[model samples]
Target: MVFPTGSLVNLIAIVLGSCAGMLLGNRLPERVRYIVFCGLGLATLVIGMQMALKTQNPLILVFSILLGGITGELLQIERGLNSLGERLKKRLKSNNLRFVDGFVSATLLFVIGSMAILGPFDEALRGDRTLLYTKSILDCFASVPLAASFGSGVLFSAVPVFLYQGALTLFAGVLQPMLTPAMMNEIIATGGLMILGIALGLLDVKRIPLSNLLPSLVYAGVLSYFFM
Candidate 1:
């Protein structure tokens, strides 16, 4: 069994970054935060596009997305995520208006990227922490500005980071033998589409219920296994 040491490191990084941001947050200009956020959006958009373009079978991608979207809608995954965040905010008895926003936004940002997906896979399959280590550095810096903007709620995002990435790492360990190169590509492509939507939301172009599309990655893998 593979231990999620990388995710542990990521969790620690987020905690440290959040604490540092809370200390220096007031010192950083809002304009600086805004510009940094926009930069992250642009970079995420490019990365999403690059990952999406790796699809070997467009038909499989389309069907996977369609099925996954429908499944996610039925499951109400986005609503559940929001409700969870809101509940956490309420339990904390906090007055921060952006608590849920911060929690959800930071969770998405940390969870949606290619590094978030591939890093765990690499670690589980080959015991290589290189990708996850790199992601830890990136996420650490990203959380600084996010925590500065969102306050203490950004710190809580680390919980989901641990859960999601750790789950992926465990599942990858079990599924390593079954996963084909094509299936992996399809899964990544599906996640890429979700990331693209997330980028658009960050850029203020549109808000997509990316959490609702989470099942798409599963569908992509299933379809790729049989069809590809």
Candidate 2:
């Protein structure tokens, strides 16, 4: 179970970006911070749109969302995550620590896309770092704005990204056999739609319960397994 070097590099960049953002956030004016957020929102939209266009199976995507949303709702991922963040915040007891919003938002922003999952598989099995490297660059830039808006809590998100992608990459050998090209494409497309929702939320166009839809990615994979 060996993880790719790209995952490790991505993790480092995220941590560094968050730290840099936190350090510089205090010096940035409110207007600048607001503009950064807007920039992030637009970037997210562009990425999501591009990813969405890659899919040919709309039915799979729709069904994946339906089943995945149900699973996520049952699992109570949003509530559970908020509870965990609240507990951590309380334990730390730092008035400056607003952990839940930043941590959750940043984690989703970094992890809920096609590249996040696909990158690990690509790197671990194929020794290709193109997607992961690109994702890391995007994450680094995104973190700057996120940290400015959310404060130090954004830095903590690196923990989840590391754990999630590291585990995926480590197990890439086992999963590689089961994952096919079409399956991977469907999963990426599903994640792209989710990322679009997140972008809309960031832009304040609509507030989507993205956490509740997290199971959709799993559903997409399963659906892909059956169909692809």
Candidate 3:
């Protein structure tokens, strides 16, 4: 059995990057960090567009997003995620004012990207770790400035990263027999839209409630199973 090596490696990279950032303190300039984030955002945008283009069923994709967006809003998934981040911040008893911000931002940044979803699926379905490996390197760099600016709270994001991706990997393994190539393509396309939103947020263009769109992935799969 192939382990979820990708997530484990990603978790370690985040931790190490956070520690390095904290150690470096204010040495890393704000402008440099900002540029790095911008570069990441652009890269994410390109990746998302590519993934979105893979869908063979555009109508199903639209319906999945619509239905999933409604369900997610009704459930207040984004609010719940923010509330969880705030709770963790309080529980940690850290005086850092940016603790919650760091935790929430890092969590969204790491989890909302296309790689986060597709990488796990690949690993579980085909034992391929290429995307996850690439994501790990990108995330390691991303974590450094996040920790530098937001303090140690950035490290906690690793927890959610492991939990979210690890669960996806396991779930994908279970569904491997049922999921067709078309289903996978639709699911990835839905995730790509959410990733585009995240990219906008990272680029400081606009903030979208991406967590609220999580259900879109499920909708994509269901819609594909039935219609495609």
Give the C-alpha lDDT of model 3: 0.84
- The number of clashing residue pairs in each candidate reads 0, 0, 0
Range of the 10 consecutive residues with the lowest summed lDDT in candidate 3: 24-33
TM-score of each: 0.92, 0.93, 0.86
Please give, for residues 1-228, the per-residue lDDT of candidate 3 as tens digits.
457899999999999999987777568777876776688679878877887888898998899889988999999988898788778878888888878767877887788666887799899888899999999998898788778878788899999999999988988867677888899889888877877876787788998887778898899999899998
TM-score, predicted candidate 1 vs. hidden true structure: 0.92
Task: Name the 10 consecutive residues with the lowest summed lDDT in model 1.
Answer: 96-105
TM-score pick, better of 1 and 3: 1
Error of 2 at 92 (Å): 2.8
Off by over 4 Å in 1: none
Which residue pairs collide, candidate 1? none
Q: Model 1: per-residue lDDT, tens digit, 119-219?
A: 99999988999999999898888788778778878899999999999998989967777888899899888878878887897788998888888888889
Q: When superposed on Cα atoms, how far off is each prediction in RMSD?
A: 1.7, 1.7, 2.4
Error of 2 at 50 (Å): 1.2
What is the RMSD of candidate 3? 2.4
- Which one wins on TM-score? 2
What global local distance difference test value does model 1 have? 0.86
Shift in Å, residue 120, candidate 2: 1.3
What Cα-based lDDT does every candidate model obtain? 0.86, 0.83, 0.84
lDDT by residue (tens digit), candidate 2, 1-228: 555688778888888898899888899999988888888899899988888777778999999989988888899998887787677678877466556788788888899888888889888888888998998888888888888778767777887888888888899899889877888888888888988998887788997778888888878888888876
